[model samples]
Target: MSQVIGTVLSALGRLGMIGAIMAAFGVGLAGTIYLSLRSPEVEVPDIVSKDRFDGEATLRDSGLNVRIRASRYKADAKPGTILDQSPRAGEVVKVGQTIAVVLSREPKEGEAPAGRDEDADDAANAESSRGGSSDTNKNDNQNRNQRSKNVNRNTVNKNANKNTANQNAGNRNANTNRIANRNANVANRNNNQNTNNRNAVRNIANVNRRAPTPATTPANPAGNRP
Candidate 1:
């Protein structure tokens, strides 16, 4: 039993350093492997000068998450631009770490220059409206002028027709008067001829009545002395 114990102790003493060295090597190898498999840190990109969407995309492409945590008004800066970042520009961070950012806010209501453009648009619309009304009025005036012109032409035509009718009536009256005067002159000539014939017949009858008794007495004495 003493010799067996001695042999066992000697064998253990010889194998212990080898086992320790192997264990140490194995641990070191495992640690190296673990380190190799771990993801490396990345530098945060400078996104302050970039648009928010562009910055966010750039961070995402670099294996980082992005968070828009707040916004501040900046009239000099472009709207929606990255203003500031936490874990600021050129910061080293692990993969999937979030880069918090503040963005510039857009101009608020009643403070935008777009209102001026709208006012210009309104002015343009008003001008167009006025122009349209003027055009309408002009058209109405043109139509009225045309109507007046037509009325004047119609009146002139009617007067011309009336004058033509009056002239024709005057001509007919002149013709009728001439024919009446001619008929009266013909009747007077016929009456004068008839009176002359009657006077001649009356004179012949008076001469016969004055000479009849003396003529009968002279013819009886030439035929018989008694």
Candidate 2:
């Protein structure tokens, strides 16, 4: 009986070791399956300032998806160039996670590519603004000149009217003075004629009164002498 118990105990020990080994292996397998099924973490690559197509390809190779967040004009960046990216470079992200990026495009229709000279674009824009300002100033100057000319013309017209009015007033004054002088001369001539007529009438009446008394006395004496 002792030998049989020893043998059974040894068998039991072997079974326990095998079961422990199997359990450990099963746990390891289960852990490996869970890791395989779940998405993995990945490092985000540097894509900023790179071409959009090239960066997209790089992101895809890194097991990431590209999400275009926005497209805008950047004076410093060329057309279709990547300007910025979310979850920046070297940051840990899950595999297949979307990397939102901002891209650069042409500022206007038919704009040339800004290859590397960002200052040149700024200069061109500044020059255009200056040109527009110059045009506005030129138009303003023209309008001012026109307004000044109109004012001068109006002043000249007013001066001409004033001179005409003064000349008319002078003419009227001269005519009035001439009429008064002519009336005074006519009145003096009429007064002198009236004085001469009164003197002649007085002389004729005196001569007749001085001769009539002597002639009547001579006729009465002649009748008495006969």
Candidate 3:
């Protein structure tokens, strides 16, 4: 009976030792599993519909690095709101991981789009060319008008000079004609006075000669009679 009791005590001691060893092994395995499962990563949060500053802040709070990818125009979407994101929301990523995003903005009224900058530059160049052309045309017109005015003035001055010369020439001709007529009248008066004096002298001489002849004839007749 003593031997059986000793044997039974020995078996109980062995079972207790086994149980303790199993429990220790189980605890070690559980600790390893928990450690292996743990990671230093967080979920990427959704920042859509948030303002640009607010979205970046939220991304930073969610253990992410924020970067702007691009901007887009969405007519129905909110202006200056987060539009899209890389590494979509709820995706597990390492802490301080960069998240690229696209920002959204509505097109303004009468505002040109970003894609139209080159076209706008071309339009501006064309408009400048047109303006330059218009200015050139205006300058040409002004020059022509000024030249026309000058020509007209010159023509008027020439006509005036011509008229003055003709009038002077007519006056000179009239003066010459008057001088010639006065000289002719003076010559004619002198000739008439010389002719009248000659005729009077001849008549007196003839009358005196006739008187002498008659007196001589009467003397001769008286002598003969005596």
Cα-lDDT of candidate 2: 0.81
lDDT of 1 by residue, 1-226 (tens): 9999999999998899899999999999999778756968998888876998999899999899987766656667788888667666676777777877767777776664333454344334433533444566899999999999999999999999999999999999999999999999999999998999999899999888887574444467557667
Off by over 4 Å in 2: 1-132, 206-212, 217-226
- Collision pairs in model 1: none
Candidate 3 lDDT over residue span 1-226, tens digit each: 9999999999999999999999999999999777656647899898877898998899889878888766766655677888666666887877777887767767768755545564344334433533444566889999999999999999999999999999999999999999999999998988888888998899999888888544454457556665
lDDT of each: 0.78, 0.81, 0.78
User: Would you list the clashing residue pairs of candidate 3?
Assistant: none
Measured with C-alpha atoms, the lDDT of residue 83 in candidate 2 is 72
Among all windows of 10 consecutive residues in model 3, the one with the lowest summed lDDT is 122-131
Candidate 3: list runs displaced more than 4 Å: 1-131, 213-226
Q: List the residue pairs that clash in candidate 2.
A: none
Q: Candidate 3 versus the native: TM-score? A: 0.38
lDDT of 3: 0.78
Candidate 2, 1-226: lDDT as tens digits = 9999999999999999999999999999999778766868999999988999999999999999998866767777788898767766897877887888778987888766445365344334433533444566889999999999999999999999999999999999999989998988888888888888888889888888787564554457556665
- Which 10 consecutive positions of candidate 1 have the poorest summed lDDT? 122-131
Clashes of each: 0, 0, 0
Ordered from best to worst lDDT, the candidate numbers read: 2, 1, 3
